[model samples]
Each structure stands twice: as structure tokens, then as C-alpha cells.
Target: MLQVKHLLADKGNRIYSVAPDEPVLAAIRTMADHTIGALLVMRGEELVGIVSERDYARKVILKGRSSSDTPVQDIMTSPVISVNPADTVDTCMRLCTDSRVRHLPVVENGKVVGVVSIGDLVKAVISEQGAEIEHLQRYIAG
Candidate 1:
């Protein structure tokens, strides 16, 4: 069973975050610039919320709210569901599915470490499958 730590070891567990007071537009711009879907919202060093593309589309665009005027705290998902380095990829998959969320921030000792998305877990699963297939093929060739 592959652990989240294995993934973080390769990715170096860096989480991009923004202040909760930042404008919603700032979050949107950050996502666009990073080519990512979400941003972890923080107040100083404390994790406060999470902003995603869905939040902007549903809360700001649909409601006709001005992103430049509204704060991310008004839109971000609070009390983010997080994971630990020791958590298994299967656990992360289940959490994302059950929560209906694509991103899960990893934390240790009350500090944000990294963020994992559904794509990350899927990629890991594919890599594991490929390795297993290669092993089986090698056995058959032998």
C-alpha cells in the first residue's frame, strides 16, 4: 500500500496559500497563474479555509458578485478536510470521494505541508498498476 508520504517525498510537500483577507479575485488569479484549481486560505500561519474554482463559479459568478470586492473568507470552504503524510492513498481517495472535493491539504503539527488532488491519487494508482504489470510480464517471460 503506497503512503501519502511516498508521494510527498517526490513532490517535496509545498502548499500554496493566501491570506483570508485577500480578495476573491486574488485567489482566482493565483489559481489561473499556477494552472491549479484551488488555494489554501490562511490567517497568518493558521489554516482557515480553502478556495476552489467551484466556489468562484457557484458563489461569485452565478450570484453576480464582484470578485474584487468580496473576500475569499466569504466564499472559501471552511474547516478543510486534511490528510497526513502517513495516510494511505486509498484513504485519500475515499476522503475526496466522500467529501465531494478534489483537493486535500496535508498537515503536520498544525502546519500545512502539501496539497494533494484527485489527479494525484489517480496518477499514483496508474503508476502502481504499471509497475505491477511490468513485474507480471517479467515473471511470465522468465
Candidate 2:
């Protein structure tokens, strides 16, 4: 089975993070600049929470809260669900589905290594299937 480490190896695990005390607007700007959906809320080196577009739409826009005035901690999802590098893609798929979350921070030795999204997992699965199909086709032609 494909693992999170395998996906990260192919994708180049780069973690984008924001501070909890920062304004939500800043986080939004960073996300836009990176073309990403979420940011890890970090306090120094510790992973404190996660902020996403969904959080902004639901917590700030819906409530008519000013993004510039609001801190990420106020809208960020805390007590994050994380995974290890050795975790299987199937395990991540189940975790994301069961938790109703799109992202999972990869932790190793209590340090954040990378983050994986639902899209990443799906892409990995599709790639794996494609490779298997190619291998089968080669075998059949032999």
C-alpha cells in the first residue's frame, strides 16, 4: 500500500504555516498567494491549530466578523487530527472521511513534517492504480 511518505516524496512536502495571533486576513492572503486551502497555525514550533477557507466562510463571513480584526485562533480548528509518515493512504482517506476534514498534518517525533490533503490522497491512489494497470498491460502483452 502507498504511504504518506511516498506521496510526500513525490509531492515534496512543504508546510505553510500562520501564527495564531495573526489576523485572519493575513492567513487568507497567504493561502491565496500559495493557492492552497489551509494553513497550519503555529505558535513558535508547535502546531496549535489549522485554518482553512471553510473556516473563514463559516466562522467569519457567516457571522459578519471582520477578518482583519479577527485572530486565526478564533476561527482555527484546534486539537488537530494528524498522521505519521508511515501511515497508509487508505488510512488517511478513512481519517479524512470520518473526521470531515480535508487536511492532515504529518507528525514525526512530535515535530510537524508535512501536511497532506484529501486531494493528495486521491491523486496518490489514482497514480497507484495507473501504475498497476500499466504493469498488467505489460504482463498481458508478454
Model 1 alpha-carbon miss at residue 99, Å: 0.9
Expressed as tens digits, the lDDT of each residue in 8-110 for candidate 1 is 8877777788888899999999999989999999888899999999999999999999999999999999989999999999999999999999999998889
Overall lDDT per candidate, in order of appearance: 0.92, 0.97
Cα misplacement distance, residue 92 of candidate 1 (Å): 0.4
Give candidate 2 regions above 4 Å deviation. Answer: none
* Tens-digit lDDT string for candidate 2 (1-142): 9999998998888999999999999999999999999999999999999999999999999999999999999999999999999999999999999999999999999999999999999999899999999999999999
TM-score of 1: 0.96
Candidate 1 local distance difference test against the native: 0.92
User: What is the lDDT, from 0 to 100, of the residue 102 in candidate 1?
Assistant: 99
Off by over 4 Å in 1: none
- Count clashing residue pairs in model 2: 0
All models, RMSD in angstroms: 0.9, 0.9
